[model samples]
Target: MYRYRITAEIRRDLERIELLRERFDNRGTLPRRWLGRLRRDLEAESVAASTMMEGVRVTVEEVRRLLAGDTPPTVDELSASLVLGYRDAMSYVLRRADEPSFAWHAELVKAIHDRVMGGAFGLDAGRFRTIPVFISDGSDGEPVYTPPAEDLVPDLVDGLAEYLESSKELPAPVVAAFAHVRLAGIHPFKDGNGRTARVVAALAMYRGGYRAPEFTSLEEWWGGHRGEYHTAFDCLGKRWKDSSDVTPFVAAHVAAQRIQADALSLRLATQREIWTAIEDRVE
Candidate 1:
């Protein structure tokens, strides 16, 4: 099983995230229509961010247009396909998050991969890679990281499912962090491993009741800070190994939660002020 110690810093960060989440939840009540608009906007942002992390070149506005049943003339079919696929997978994450019977399983992971990669790149959708895979920098095409042998992919992914099921007692952010890195380390599919890993992390957070966009979506932070995001996995070394400590990745994930939550708080305050101004003008 994958292992990581949740240091004191992580705990404090998690506490801060919880406090911010509490405030957001307790901020009286916004009209359902307004909340719905926010949800749609965040969903578009998440889809764009997650797909863009995998090198898709679609903008958030393009994704929003696509999600709203309009095709942007600037978005090519390939980029549009990737964005719509990710949007479908994220929609699944939101639905499953609300379900009382949701559980971690291999099939569920594969299903998500299918949604993410099935449309854009039909390379082994819903299936683990039968061939070995390596991560390469686009410039040199040299392998930066080599995953486990193809033979081990099945067992490794199954082990991840088992670990997720067993770790239900841990805090949501911690579980989410681990889920992100573990699946990423396993590199289960031929492609879409990163996208699958991210969706899994979101599912973990959502299932743990981190339903707010600020609490659930890290793709925006990750999409913007791609370097820091990849560097967090340096602890895993050049290959997958059981002994690798994942503390750095977990800490980074927690810190991202805090940053995003803080940003959301500020954003909400601005929105509230704008709203008050509009009301005053009307009066």
Candidate 2:
């Protein structure tokens, strides 16, 4: 219930929460000028993080346009404008959508990858894989990792769906963390597993009433922290094998969120200050 016992998982990160609270509380009493500065700084950081997360080059003006309800520019448009590749451009669009669900998850991943790779991307777009595929390290070209057997996909998907359905009863952060770990552990599809997992994590947060936590670009953060992140999954895989026990994974996930929260809080305070200075001069 409440998305796979997330309370237990969150308990592992209490220290991180305390650190975040301390940072947040320390910035509580700023003057109006300082508040303005903080707001601007937060906006800038938000735009920068968002652009990075989307995996495209986007101008501040383009970001403003997208936020203001202008027709979202296509992946090709983003590629040309930002000088990024097709794959990166599509990743940006996939991550930017605020409302994502399980059904939409399949469709978006397939469409984005297809658009990037030139047609119906995965072996199963809306369906789970029915064959076992080896997950190899790009660096080593060896089949070092293998997912569950074909027969187990249905049960795994069912468990995930049930967990998502029960997520409403959980805390926002816990739900987000659990979703990320569980989905990534499932490794549902052969390709786009990581991206799919990140999108699922974001959707869980959106459902839990938090803004999509753009702590870091998923690819940037995960790619940079690949060793640790993979270690967590590998450790769990060896221990749990079939059943999902995402406690360790959740700990890492929440730690990432805590870092993002701290950065965002400080950035917000700085932006508030800058805005106040500009307003005071104008007045």
Residue 153, model 2: lDDT of 58
Candidate RMSDs in order = 1.5, 7.2
lDDT of each: 0.85, 0.53
- lDDT per residue for candidate 2 within 1-283, as digits (tens), equals 1123446546656456555555555545667656564444434334434344335555545544543446346434533322222234334444554435434334444444333322333334335566777766668887656666767755665676676676577665666676666655566665545555665565565555554234322433454466776776654443226555666677677766666665566656566677768789989
> How accurate locally is residue 55 in candidate 2, as Cα lDDT from 0 to 100?
51
In angstroms, the error of model 2 at 211 is: 2.8
Give the best candidate by lDDT. 1
lDDT of 2 at 236: 47
Model 1 per-residue lDDT at 34 = 63
